[model samples]
Target chain A: MLKCNNINVKNILCDVSFEVKRGSFTSIIGKNGSGKTTLANCIASQRKYGGSISLGNTSMLDISPCDRARIMAYLPQSLPSPNISVYDLVTLGRSPHTSLGAKLNKSDIESIDNALAVTGMTMLSNRMVPSLSGGEKQRAFLAMTLAQNTDILLLDEPTAHMDMHVAAEFTELLNRLGKTLIVIMHDLSLAIKYADNVLILDSGKQIFFGSKKDLLVTDTIEKNFNVRKIENDGEIIFTV
Target chain B: MKKLIIIFTPLLCISIILGCAFGSADIMQLIGNDTDTALIIILNLRLPRVIAAVLCGIGLSVSGVLLQCVTGNTLAAPNIIGVNSGAGFCCIVMLTFFPKASVLLQIGAFAGAFITTLVIVGIASHINAFRGTVILAGIAITAVLNACISFLSLLDSDVLTAYNAFSVGGLAGIRMSQLYVPAIIITGCLLCSLILSRRIQLLCLGDAIAASLGVSISKLRIACIILASASAAAVVSFAGLLGFVGLVVPHMARRISGERTSKLLITSSMIGAILVILADLFGRIILAPTEIPVGIIMALIGAPFFFILLFKRRGDNAEM
Candidate 1:
């Protein structure tokens, strides 16, 4: 399990403490400025934090960069569609897998191929990333993380601005991966659908963090979430 | 393919060797001899000048590529941080303040580039500045430093005849001592450039991604600044300030090889070296007996190419 102890994420994130178990699908849901992305960046070791963050028995700081990259791969909310071609960008995922002087081997190629295949982006593998559609761009980043083959993934809003069909398809893709996936999202339905555990944040503080059943029973997000309006009957409909 | 690319730099060197050796007509025959004229020109004058052009071109372009990548801005050159002006200002002041001081002039140029590099890095860190800020700081400093140089030059305008010649950047009057250091520096720098090329590409992704990939932001930036400073300093020390090779070479090479820094650096240097040698030849042949400074020729050709680069690309500058 990945553990956060007395962690105070400043700037955007407040005190966020949770345990992410192995092979569990966990999603973090929060409104804008509520610190969802901050929490993910903190976990990914991309941000400075005040408290202890431990992966299993080891401290996050204790991990080497190469080891850290192997342990976790992060996909931020903005998928930077770089100017480089898709194949070259995907090749970047092999950074942690190979040593500085070592040549890439067959297993690495297999990993990249599998990543592209799983993301359903094989046909677009050679295209420039900047030229891709929003959904396709997100898939390319997913492929990068997938190609890294890390044990834990911190995805900040894995499906933002993507249409229902694309979002559903992307989430389904993540759910099937069966990895220790900690995703930050705003969509309530996706939170309810995929999360073995759901975390809700309001104004930088955690409102709830646990199974969806417990969360909805205690404080179901209604009009406050804006996009997802839930009736008192607990019936939820998501709209732009 | 890599072998083919590695061959280009050397092959271009040979072509430059031939260009310097076998030009039209015979200046040697006209000069007072023809017997060991080829050998004399090869050893004493033509060879050293060609080597100067090749090494300086490679150094300048490598420096340009390094800075541009490290800052993640296409506009970022070693000159952006007032480094060139630092060199120029030092040269002008030494020429005015100490008139006949050769040793002090070289020292001044080195001191100028080194100090300016530290200042650029310092400002970049303190301002939480991005690449654009660094470039702006450079331009602003350069303008101020150039003003200082102009004031000094105006004070000694009549006495500083040599300064006028060097300021325009020429291969003329290169001493053996000056040539040796730049050659060694370029060799060492080329090695560093190759090793750090991949890092530059990774770095261009922005600080956050580079950090996540295990690149120490401070360390990479330091390496880049120092390396670029060394290259620009060496070139400025030898031949004064020659602009646009750094800015233009990488863009042209990127058009062919895409954005990979290592490949682009090699290609840029190759292109830059050829461009300089060709320009030097044009300077030689343009009006024969009167050699136009290669710097002016480069500016004439390089300016239009630079605008094309500016238009063809926007770079990763937006985040910065």
Candidate 2:
């Protein structure tokens, strides 16, 4: 389990607390300027924060960078199309586990292959990342993160560059991966549909944190996001 | 990549032979003559010129590769980014004021290069400038340093002979004694950079991604800058601000070696050595006894390459 207790980032986030169960998909939903990325950065240990964030018994801050990378992988929204082949880029994910001069062994190669296969990028493994389309580039980066083989994945707006259909497909892929995920999502309906639990942030405050079913019945999201949630033909949708 | 190394290795050896053999006095003919003047010309002058070419080539190219990777700017080379000019300015000052203390020239050059690199990077980062802006900022810094160099040269007419030869950057009068310290420093820095190539490659992925992959971004960048400064400063101390080897050779190496930093470093070092030796040879033979400077030839080639790169990449991220 990952727990955040009264996490604060000066004026950005204030006393936001939550607990994420292992192997659960938790979607963090918030409007613009709601400090979602800041919270994600704090959990990724990329930024300083007040209060405590722990993984099981140990504090997250105490974990060495290599160990933390081994256990949790974080991907930011803005990705660079580096001029390297997809295979080489995915190979970088094994850095935390490998030594300076060590070559790729059987296990590392297998992990890279599996990541490419899982992301449907196996055919494009030899292609340069800079030549890839936006959605394909996102998949390539996703493959790199998956190759990391971490227990928890923290993504901030991972689908920002993708079209709606591709984004939906990508979300479905993430939903089936069965890893613990804390994703900051902008799409309300997608967040409501696939997330096992939801955390709502409004103006840097934790307005709600509960199971998806419980969240759907409450007015917390609608009040903060200024949107109405409706059910039609057993399908959930949000209208602004 | 293997083909690249194979092709360049022989080319480099041939260039080395040509550079040592056919200077103004034809050192090869003196091999069996057993004359003291011939031996002095061959061993003391021509041989050191060849050695200086190789060392400066490797030093500048490795420095270029490191700067480009760390800054994520394709145009970030020692010459283009004010590092060479800064070192040149300091070396000129050292030669003018403390002519008796020539041993301290490398230290002064390293201090100057290090400070210039930090200042350029600091100002760029402080304003949150993009990659192209960094190059522009470097060019501006280079202009200021060059002006300072010019002012010093004007103030002391005695500094002109050394300053004129040094400013245009040639291998005409290099002695074997000048090559020893710089050779050691360049070799050491190259080894260290090769060993750290893997971590350095991660830097091209950008800070957030590299940090997430367990590499300390700031620490690694600082280490690379120090290495680059040391190598470039060492070269400027002996070779007199030779430009464009750092800028051009890495680009060629990348074409052959792909994006792997280790492979790029090895290929770049070999290719860089070949480029300088051949350029020096051409400078010797192009105008016969007149002998144009190696820096002028490099500028003739590199200025066009830079413009082509700039215009060809105009719509890409590098242009911005």
Candidate 3:
């Protein structure tokens, strides 16, 4: 389990507390400047916070960056399009595991190959990162994070650049990955579809944290995002 | 990459041998008649010049690679971005006022280079400027530093002759005493850069990702700046603000060796050595007794390459 207690980032995020069970999917939904990314960054130890985060029983502050990276991986929103082959980019994910001056072992190669396959980017492995399309680039970076083979994945707006269909497809891929995940998303319908639990924030304050169904029943969606939640044919939809 | 290195290594060896064998003295003719003169010319004059070229080449190229990676700007090279000017300005100050403090030259140059780099970086970060803005800032600072250097030379006419030779940046009258310390410093820094190559590559991934991947972004960037400054300062101490090897050679190496830092550094060092030695040879032979500065030849080459890169990036943006 991943637990965050009273997480606060000066001016950006206020005191927020939550716990994520292992092998569960949690979606963070909020308006612009609502501190979704900041919260995720705090949990990933990418930012300073006046709180404690622990993975399992060990305090996150006690773990070295290399050890923390082995347990959790983070994918930030603004991805760079570097001029490197997809395979080489993904190979970087194995850095924390491999010893200094040591080559990748057979198992490491398998992990890389597996990550590429999981993201459905096996064929594009040889393509340059700058040449990949928007959704393809997203998957390439996802492949990198997945290759990290960590227990918890923190992704901030992973589908922000994708079209509707592509976003849905990518969300389905994330849902099927079977890892503990905390993803900040803008698309409410997709978040409701894939996430078992929902955490809503408004202007840096945590408004609600519960199951998606319970969140839809309340007026939190309407109050926070200015959208009305409806259910039809066993499908959840949010219309602005 | 191996093939690129293989082809270039031999070419570099030949350039070095030829650079040492042929010069203003025509050592070949003197070898039969006066062995002492031949030996003296080869050992005292030609050898030191060739070694200076090699050292400056490797040092500047490696330093460029480090700066480019740290700044995340391909146009960030030592000379083009005010690093060499920083060192040159300090050197002039030392030569003009504290001529007796020869032992402090290297340290002073490093301090100058490091301070200038920090200033440029500070301005860039403060404004949150883009990559091109950083290069423009560097160019602007370089012009101001150059003007200061010229003004200093005007005030102290006694330092003008020494500063003139230094300003044009040629290998005309090099000596063994000038090269020994820089050679060791360059070699040591090069090895450190190579060992940190993997971590440096991670830096290209951007700050957040690199930090998330266990690399200390601030520490790594600081380390890179220090290493790059030391290398550029060592070269500037001897070679008199040699340009272009840092800017041009790394780009050439990247084309041949891909974006891998180790391969890029290795290829850049070799290609830089060959290009500098050959440029020095060309400068020596082209004007015969007049001796064109290698800096001029490099400027002729580098300025055009810089424009090509600029337009090429614009073209790529257009394509995208």
lDDT of each: 0.78, 0.85, 0.85
Off by over 4 Å in 2: A228-233, B26-43, B80-82, B102-107, B114-151, B317-320
Q: What DockQ class does candidate 2 belong to?
A: medium
Best prediction by DockQ? 3
Q: Which RMSD values do the candidates have, in order? A: 3.4, 3.1, 3.3
Q: Extract clashing residue pairs from model 1.
A: B80-B138
Collision pairs in model 3: none
Per-candidate DockQ versus the true complex?
0.45, 0.58, 0.59
lDDT, residue B65, model 2 = 92
TM-score for each of the candidates: 0.90, 0.90, 0.90
Candidate 2 reaches a DockQ of 0.58
Residue pairs with clashing backbones, model 2? none
Error of 3 at B78 (Å): 2.2
Score chain B of candidate 1 by TM-score: 0.90
Tens-place lDDT per residue, model 2, B195-263, is 788788888887778878888666677688778878888888777778888988888787677778888
Single out the weakest 10-residue window by summed lDDT for candidate 1 chain B: B311-320
Query: B19-39, model 3: which lDDT tens digit per residue?
Result: 998767788789989999899
